[model samples]
Target: MVLVGWGEQVFRAGLKGRGCGVDEGLRELAAPFVVPDPSGVAIRTRLKQLTAVDEEVLRRVGAHLGTLASGDLKARCHDGLAHDAEAWATRKRELTPLSSARWAGAITRATHEQWALARRCALAHLQSLQAGVHALRHRLSLPLGQKGSKRAPGGYRSRREWHAKARRLRVLEDRLARERAAWQAGRVHVVRGGKRLARMRHQLPAAQLTELQWRARWEAARWFLRADGESGKRYGNETIRIGPDGEVSIRLPAPLAGLANAPHGRYVLTGRVRFAHRGTEWADRVAVNRAIAYRIHHDPVRGRWYVTASWQTPASPAVPLAAALGHGVIGVDTNADHLATWRLDVHGNPTGNPRRFPYDLSGTTGHRDAQLRHALTRLLHWARTCGVRAIAVEDLDFTAEKTREKHGGRKQFRRLVSGLPTGRLRARLTSMADAMGLTVVAVDPAYTSKWGAQHWQKPLTSKNRRITRHDAASIAIGRRAQGHPLRRRTTPPRAHRSDVHGHRIVQAGGDAPGREGPRRRLPGPRTRSVPPDAERTRATRTPTTVRGVRGEQEWVPDSLLLTD
Candidate 1:
């Protein structure tokens, strides 16, 4: 979603207004000519002075008419009408009205206007048709590397766009020549002005002086034109400036000289939209990490101006950190759940996160990791103060990669990426480390996690394997862990698996493999048995009564501990 910003000034529609009203003027200029007058005064006129069409031809000479867009054609047509209308009127004044020449005069003048409009439009259409064919031929010349149907791979075109133009061009050219010759050769002049009409030339006002200026502006915007699909010519923001003052002063492009609104699909009748009280302006500059303006459009329903721009963000750069104890190599494993880090010392043996590993910020060690940048910033600052030397991080190639938002259910990957404090962490860490002359290394992250954090009392086997949770971390102490550690009993931490799960198994004995002995037992239950049947019988039999040396109380029961 793009936000509406400034530069709403580009949507004004009054520049074309400065130019003549092509159709309206043409109709007015034609009105007098098309009616008969009682007085006759042989009016003389020059061929070039009569119409917008003369200008149309001159413009079309430079215009790739066949390639001329509809907007361009409409513009040209507007110019033609305006000019032809005025010229037609001026020359018609040269002829005195006849008492009986009303209908004839109107028909003759109307015929002249139609003929001119048809010729210009048809010529543009024909040229476009031929150009289109040539272009298609070039495309078809390429090897059809693969084969299929009309819409197949590597095809020329699915449909031709300039067919009708060719027919119209041929038809109009034929008709114009025939009529011109008929009039020039003194075929007929039913009304008083009819003879002078043949000398008048017609041009549409849409493509006249003012309109040509707009076109020139469009041509100047090379790249912008390519990107925005040639959105017609702009008049240097004058339309907007003019509307506010209710007055306009502008240099006229020859094409706009006698311009007027065309009746059906007329030049001004089309892409020219008129709005009430809208502000428009040209953009001066665009900033970074901010939205870039796209375009301004006028909404008829809202009656309000809106602008749209989108923000393009940069990638998450890396940060390097190092400390004493020869810890330089850093391993980072990022996943959907958490980021695991291993800090390897001088000998390349990696240690796990410390109680104060500087990554943890809030909840568990994992929470600290989530706020990686924030935590890194603090830790890096602390490290700098403590005089750490070098910092290292894993380096994996990004190489033109893009993350695909999973099309399935809610993507766990996207959530994890969003929640990570990636960008800030990298920036702050890199800055702090570099300032302190701490070497920042982005090394391979491949198998750094294979070795457990520091040395494990037990092997990396299933029975002894530990997995860190989203809320826990394993903290590695020194070589001998110093003192007996006072047997500070507490909950054990979780494990890391992303790039750490190695293939080490633990043995049942206390010692790892070669140094182990048989399993030790604790006081529990008798699990041994004597000779089977005989022992069983002895245990089950009752003892016989025996005479013991008579002491006055010689009543000892024959149950001396129940010997088996």
Candidate 2:
């Protein structure tokens, strides 16, 4: 997600709704491409069709899709199928298997798409192919759209986009090779990077298909990617699966959001699976439409597939989220120290508000990040148990890397959060929620903690703000160090709260002794959210007791209070 300035008025509005026309179109496209008695042709034969039977021109395109990247190859095929339902009926075409002309049209369509992409936007060209495949499955598998065709969208610029994409692609390639080498040895290096990027690496070992598809869809989305790092998002009840074998596929229909003019809210789902059948076991042809998506034939070396196509024509209405949205919302306050939280009921009242959970590690603070993480996880687990579906958190400033506090410890923390990486909490939360079928909503936590009740806010003045409060507000008149004998007066934030005989008392400062010299006033109260580059909130040592009043206690650890 791109981060605009805070004052830019970020509205969490959904994209314009559109009926799944593309999906329907794809499903319809696939309906005629399916072949019953498939004659699997060799990959070489498929390559020969595009090039002459001789070895010269065919070598230019390369034997596989991977080889086609460098050279300026034209995918000269049909932009789309050229068949009308009425015309087909008039021609008395059978509804069963794909005909020779139909197969030719498929190749034509592939060629046309490739050509279209080359001239305008390379990314869009790629995105369309993948989205076409995705939309096809959605429409075919489930009834997803009413008879409709929204304005077919175009792709974006592919030049600068490809450079950035290529960099990442190369990085992915290097990582994959290292992983493969490590994997073959039975044990792998403890990858100290992202689990999702890692898992994504494993799911798509070779970057060819995924890489091509990513660029393609980015082009399709008009160069806009879904916020929250999703190129395309799936909302309602959709479950994507990868077979045990290295077959890449997803069943659309339910939960696949942001589709061909598909409206917001929820959808029952609709779409069909499409893939190229490349093996000579089946005659070379583009196939589409059927329950499961066709993986077609794959190459062992390039890890590419051909003879596959995506089906469309799925349709469903958007529905309300019965469990995911309506139940309750869990608001997580991701902190630099710990994960503070407050659970709100349906009416937006704080029902189960818990003080900040202890997420600070003894030696290293970054490792304690897992505590906040685990706390969020526990909250999710609780939400799951409590039947609360959606979790809400503030949108974090994560697009750019920000400096962070160094968490110590040789092993406890390790690379858990070595150099701060302030964006970990929300990132992890969203990802975990995705796997658990939970919906996560991001809100603006602009002034939640800064603006509190009078009882919570009355302690920062020079005088004891709590005049009616008990003796806990006392300052032990102690002397400054050295021969300079002097009476010192100051109030200090102490550790260990006490409520003896209805009188509140606490130790001044924390675990260690007072300063070596006289003490200057400590920092002021820190704001809820830390400043991006600089520390925003000031720290203060004034003690606050809310036993009879708000009863909300500020739990600054004894550590920060300790004068080192």
Give the number of the best model, judged by lDDT: 2
lDDT of 1 at 370: 51
lDDT of each: 0.31, 0.33
Q: Write the per-residue lDDT of candidate 1 for residues 375-461, one digit (tens) a residue.
A: 455545544554434444433222111122111122543333334444344554565554444544443222123222222323322
Clashes of each: 63, 70
- Global Cα lDDT for candidate 2: 0.33
Best prediction by TM-score = 2
